[model samples]
Target: MTETKEWFESWFDSPYHGMLYQRRDEHEASAFIDKLFAWLQPAAASSVLDIACGDGRHAAYMKNYVHEVIGIDLSEQRIQKAQKLAKENLAFYKQDMRNVFRLNYFDYAFNFFTSFGYFQHYRDNVIAADSFAKSLKPGGRLMIDYMNVDRVKDQLVAEEVVEVEGICFNIHRKSENGKIIKTIQFKDASGKPYSFEEVVSEFRLPDFKELFERCGLQLITTFGDYELNPFNVEVSPRLIMIFEKH
Candidate 1:
């Protein structure tokens, strides 16, 4: 496969990518969603939007709370998988976050599980923030769950190897040029090889605050983890932010 500079297009769509991350704790994700639902207190008529919703897992889970949920992602494979689970109250779309999905359409928007910060250019991040702002109704809320760059840097693991379903996966991770990059190499039972890399920007609270301010969004609060504890730059595993449209 000819890989492009935009690595997510190839990496996220691969079956191996899904297999590697299949062990994510659904119970923990649901608990966080439940807590966020209580905090947002969305009404029955309110609509929810899930950005970069891989396989629509959280978006499907969110339908139990909101009247309607719409999930969007750049990967067609994930969207096709998500489509199987769609219901009257839940829907999925193949779309990019940097593009506007709908103007003033949703009351609540979520970018969960470190979905943001994938683009190579800083302006793409700004454009995504603006798109999120444009897609929300006035005073609408947005929740973004992202990795804490500082914590990730402090706990950096340079390399690791794992075997999944009889396939060997060699993983390498590093932080460079204000981004964290992970490269994965593996082979199938037939000895066919595959390789992919994931790159995420090292954005902090201040960076997000500036982006939000410029995009007509207000930074409401920041949390440290799925537990919704206060954010600490030095020790927090995640930087979960809640923002509102201004």
Candidate 2:
């Protein structure tokens, strides 16, 4: 867990990281984000903070809906690309989500694309939650998009491979306790492999309810997908949680 940051930094700097998103199905991702924002429906005057905002795709898309959008990620390369592509209403910053940077400033905070999990230490996660809480104004909204752990566990595949933009990736998953341990290995055109492992903490409905309560947030809504559909153990591919500061 302690090595997670090193792993991410290395992985992000590798050629595979840039190529990975370039090859992703943009149509699907765009649809997914569109539905997500529709559900969020941020006020036009609201300021948004996007944590781990990879490449700022969501921030760029969100610019039309919000007054200002700030996207932060730990990867400098990703932030650089994001800065290059961002609109006037959107800005990208390189920062660790766990550390406190400034005061209460945002009306809404978003952690999308399963970006909440990764820290080796539970305290790190809590620190991040605290930072998020402190960053938001009173009654600010928080939207978290994470993997549907139960669904993923039940449908777990030992190994899978996908190819996009001339790059290939092999993904593997193993479940232990309430966590899914994932390894993504990327292969370039020459077949060289670069890999990273991520441990995702699994939380059930009650678990999230408790976690949010402990973090001084109230769960406003839960959806199985970006479409705002009711969530159940069997159907949804994602666990979208909407919370409000207490």
Q: How good is model 1 by TM-score? A: 0.97
Looking at model 2, residue 219 earns an lDDT score of 92
lDDT of each: 0.93, 0.80
lDDT for predicted candidate 1 compared with the true structure: 0.93
Candidate 2: regions farther than 4 A off: 1-6, 21-23, 164-168, 186-193
- lDDT score of residue 187 within candidate 1: 89
For residue 114, give model 2's deviation from the true position in Å: 0.6
Where does model 1 exceed 4 Å of error?
1-5
For each candidate in turn, the TM-score is 0.97, 0.88
Can you give the lDDT of residue 2 in candidate 1?
Answer: 75
Give the range of the ten consecutive residues with the poorest summed lDDT in model 2.
1-10
